[model samples]
Target: MRVLLVEDDQFHASYMEDVLAETLPEVTEIFHAMNGEEAEHEARALTIDAVVMDLRMSRRNGIDAARTLWMERPETRILFWSNYADEAYLRGIATIVPEDSAYGYLLKTAPRDRLKLALRAVLVEGQIMVDREIHRLQRRAASPRNTLDDSEFAVLLDLAIGLQDRIIAERRGMSLRTVQNRLLSLYEKLGVDDEASDAMPLNKRVRALNRALVTRTLNIETLETAQRDFDRWQSTRKRA
Candidate 1:
């Protein structure tokens, strides 16, 4: 099987190369790419059956690359290898993956055998795989399983995208008062100080967003997904 290895770190790239060579001997060609943009270019120019992608990188990330790659060819399988089993990453993965796509999310700390197994599952069996730890985090984050109700979470996404309360209410079919109330609840759940204290305004959404980001509740992938959704919503509204 021909594969594309997309990683930014030289050492990790070299390591992945060795793993591919040693573990999957049937893998005929392994293409190396430094970052997501390069990966996109190579994928467009080459015949890649599967891709082993790193989640974080400079310039562009694996999620962005994978989205574009799948857009180009939805049948290509993918293996996401990352050090972080972050819920944000898992959330982002959910948004970008094509319908009925075959993709695996494996931790970087996983053993070689585990890695090989996940690779084969995505590449051959067309199954989805996730590290148990990450899977638990995702499960725990789902509604009723954790804090933040759907309405409040919707407010969070709107806030993360820098939407005004009025616009958020309009988009979500909520009253302005209801939107503001949800934002307050979201702030409490996120442990953000949303009250005015002469230091910042009570409705300082920017500060709240920054706090959420530091807490890993809002990640780059989350932001990108939110932006995409917002853009689509805006476009649909325009047409209507």
Candidate 2:
């Protein structure tokens, strides 16, 4: 398999190349890029089987580049690598990629073997591998406002991410009062009577809900796979 790797850090880029070469001997060729712009250009220029991208970059950012690649190369698989485990990023990416595609979002600190496994799963199974932390975050976002309409769910997601009502309203092109009212309704549905209750800050409550969602969405088999992936990651770290 041919792969395109986009990462700015020299050490990580080199280390990843070495690991992939040693682990997946079938990866015949690997192309490297130092930034998002280069990645975007290379992605368009090459006939790569899959892309391994770093999220943080000096220009464009991984998500933007991934979106571009997804639009331009619908058949190419994308594997996102980031240090952040933010839910908003996951949701934003999900909005772009189809569920059937070979896509994955993983933490930069993930074990090398787990990274290899994620790539294999995408290439072989066409499954998207989400970092467990991201799955947890999504579950949290989904849980807190299960009764929320689509708009309300969007609003709550923004709220949990610390977006102000006015900012969210402007982004959604709705009035601030509408946002407030939606939040009030959501609180009622969640049975959260006190807005300032210690038991449920919007962020904390959302995270808890996300954990629950991950549990519900994953079956025993998939859960076992995730555990094995994580275990592989741990083992790689120990060796390193």
Candidate 3:
């Protein structure tokens, strides 16, 4: 089988290549891409059977690349190998993946045997294999009452980045009331209720953002992604 290996670090990529070559006897050709942009190019240029994708890259992130690839070919099988199992990454993956598509998420720190098993499960057996911790997060996110919906999550990101409610409404194409309602839901999901007993009145938005960060729901990478998007939007507005 032909496999696409997408990673930024050359040494790590070489190491993973040796691992795949040694473990998976079915792999005939392993295509290497330094980043997601190159991965996209290789996927288009080659007849890749499956992919072992790294999440964070210099040009484009793995989630964005996987989303595009899956959009073009829903049957694409990919095993996400990353150092992070952040909720933001999971949410990003959950949003784009096709319902029936088989995919896996394994951290880079995993034992070589575990990595081999995950790759075999995703690439050969066509099974879903997510790290146990990430799977727990997925379960929590699946709960409608306790988890933020996509719209709520979007509002939460806006709040985290210090956007006012009016600005968020305008940018998200949501009504001001809708934005406020989403914020309320976000607070409830984040358990940011009633800081009245505190020495000072705390901002619920800030509290919610803090709770999310502490809970690993919002990480630095999440904010960085949002910041990049905000920067792009600002550039477009300036151009206009």
The sequence of per-residue lDDT tens digits that candidate 2 reaches over residues 10-125 is: 98889888877876666889999988789889987888888888877776677767778888878888888877665445655676785466788988788878887877777545
Off by over 4 Å in 3: 136-146, 161-178, 194-198, 224-240
Tens-digit lDDT string for candidate 1 (116-203): 7887788767898887767766556544423677688778889888788999999999999999899877777666653557765555
Query: What's the lDDT of the predicted structure labeled candidate 1?
Result: 0.83
- Clash pairs, candidate 3, are none
* Cα RMSD, each candidate: 3.6, 13.0, 3.7
Worst 10 residues of 2 by lDDT: 217-226
* Ten contiguous residues with the weakest lDDT in model 3: 136-145
- 1-240: candidate 3 lDDT, tens digit per residue: 999999998887998999899888999999999888899999999998899999988788898789878988888899999988678888877878898888999888888888888888999899988888666656765465667778999999989999999989988999999999998878878878754346777789889989889877787767877887788887997898
Off by over 4 Å in 2: 136-150, 153-180, 183-240
RMSD of 3: 3.7
Clash count, candidate 2: 5
Model 2 lDDT, full chain set: 0.69
The Cα RMSD of model 2 versus the native structure comes to 13.0
Compared with the true structure, all predictions reach lDDT values of: 0.83, 0.69, 0.86
